[model samples]
Target: MRTADFHIEDARGDATVLKLTGDWTTMGLNQAAIRLGESLRGYSIEQVDLSELGRFDTAGALALVQASNFAMPANAFDTRPEAGRIYAMVETLERQSAEPPKRQAPLVRIFSKIGHGVHDAAAEILLSMAFLGRLMGATGFAFRHPGAIRWPAWVSQAERSGLDALPIIAVTNFFIGAVIAFLGADLLTQFGAGVFTVQLVAVAVLRELGVLITAILLAGRSSSSFAAEIGSMRMSQEVDAMQVMGVNPFQALVIPRLAAMVVMVPLLTFVGMVSGFLGGMLVVWSQLDYGPAFFIQRVSEDPDMGTHLMVGLVKAPVFAVVIAAIGCRQGMAVAGDVESLGRRVTAAVVQAIFAIIALDAVFALIFLELNL
Candidate 1:
């Protein structure tokens, strides 16, 4: 046949010829694909012929095969002798385009992950130790450079984190003491030991309730606030900007808050303890006909002031570190944007609270063992 234009006509019935002309390259193939797709949309395009195709290339061949694949029933065009080569090429393309099956990690790769886990654990431990060391170094530096202790910032944190939280601590501790007394009186009344309810309430409040309740309250109040404040500053790019301006984020942002909490939580705990004892005394006097003397005598007799003070005071420093660590970590980790900052702040608060509780348990176990 002479090299000329190609035409597709129906194989059966009154055939209408559709012309395919010009050099068949990528654009020609695209045009052919578009025309075939458009014609097939509204009409029942059952069959097409490319026998007159001239100057056809692989692109044109592929385009014809794609059109045939979509317009015809499966395996109907595959059986044609002229389409056998095109079908084979399409099969190879389909196979090559398919995603390869995934393989599970082998024993070696699994062991390698395990090894990395160990290294990560060790690195975390070292990081924690380094953090503590840095705190100690900062404390020492503050002692040496007393002027560097930003009094205004420290006072601001103390008033906000500790002084402002005072009313809440007092109120909660008072209710807790009242609840303890009421519960103890009811339980001891069966044995005609209602008078000794003061002793029980006093002992529990002084030894455990004071520190525990104060810590829980601070966890909810101060720690969360710290995290949110730090996260906000971080998200606002203030902390990074400080670093750019040659400011140590730790000293400028974190150390003052830590120092304030360390000094103030102990004071706050003492306030809570006093309020709790008074609340118990109130219940005892009203319900059990006992006096304030009874509560004072009972609590003071067994638990030394030094012991109570030492227990709460020691926890203050630890709680301070926990709050600062969580806040600073969350702040430094803040990605840009308000949503990420909010998430980090919430996570920091939750994690810090859980950590404080765990630390409190460990402290309780150790102190009980030490007879403190």
Candidate 2:
């Protein structure tokens, strides 16, 4: 077949003519279009002559149409019906491309995005609240009919979220307490009150650090576990199956996990407190040359032990509920995809930790007001 070729014929007025020749086919059409396009740049083409064209294909037709800027007048290709039809089609596309895109002001776009985010956040909060209400109602129902409670599931979750987690909690809190004691001893030594490190460690670990550490750890570990477990169940449609079988998913799936957290967090907190205290005692003994017996005596003599311990333990149940609720809520929100499952699981941990810290702050304010 003949190779495609085109040339701009010199014109006298504002209108120019592109004269195409040879076979207008895919082979060598792109190069022809490029050369023609560059040569025609300084001229405005209002017409095209395809009478010299021997043959034509879609690609070459499109290339010629593009090179002409789709401005070929209606009568320009009337002598060649094929060229006219192809030019008409490409002209429609060119007209469509000429339309401007609708755009919003930058400030308006920013506000629109902010409004969408706020709306989504509010919807999430309302959904979480609804989940919490459902869980609470299910819990009350279980309480009223103790036989309906899933004791086996609750025990298994306790083992997973509590007993199995003890070593990490204990080890973590121990080092934390030791660090605090070391710092307190160094600071207090400046005032010749290094002996008071015992009281400081005791009060800090028992009243705040111990429970907070346990709660944070559980938020990362157990909360994520809960989300993943329930999320998998959701993905596999097991939760829906439970509902179809007349089982209340909240009671069957969530209440047991919630009960596990409620029962175990305080216990873990107590263990963490003792572990941290022991760690502090070890640090005091080694760094300050203080005996364990003397340290124990100092801690026991602290009159605020009862109030501090009570204050710490009182927050455990609330923290447990919040963690469980966040975990289960995110699990229920999981869509039918692995990415969604992973995202919800991460959100569960983060939201639980945030809620724990915020609630702790509120509790602190309330206790401060009450002078507790």
User: Using lDDT as the measure, which candidate wins?
Assistant: 2
- As a whole number from 0 to 100, the lDDT of residue 225 in candidate 2 is 93
- Model 2: per-residue Cα lDDT over 39-61, one tens digit each: 87767777777778877777776
- Per-model TM-score, in order, reads 0.67, 0.83
- Candidate 2 off by > 4 Å: 1-42, 47-69, 73-103
Candidate 2 local Cα displacement, residue 104, angstroms: 3.1
What TM-score does model 2 achieve against the real structure?
0.83
Structure candidate 2, residue pairs in collision? none
The local distance difference test score of each candidate is 0.72, 0.89
Give the alpha carbon lDDT tens digit for every residue of 109-228 in model 1. Answer: 899889999997697557657766776777788889888878898889989988998999999889888999999998999999997897777666776787778877787777767767
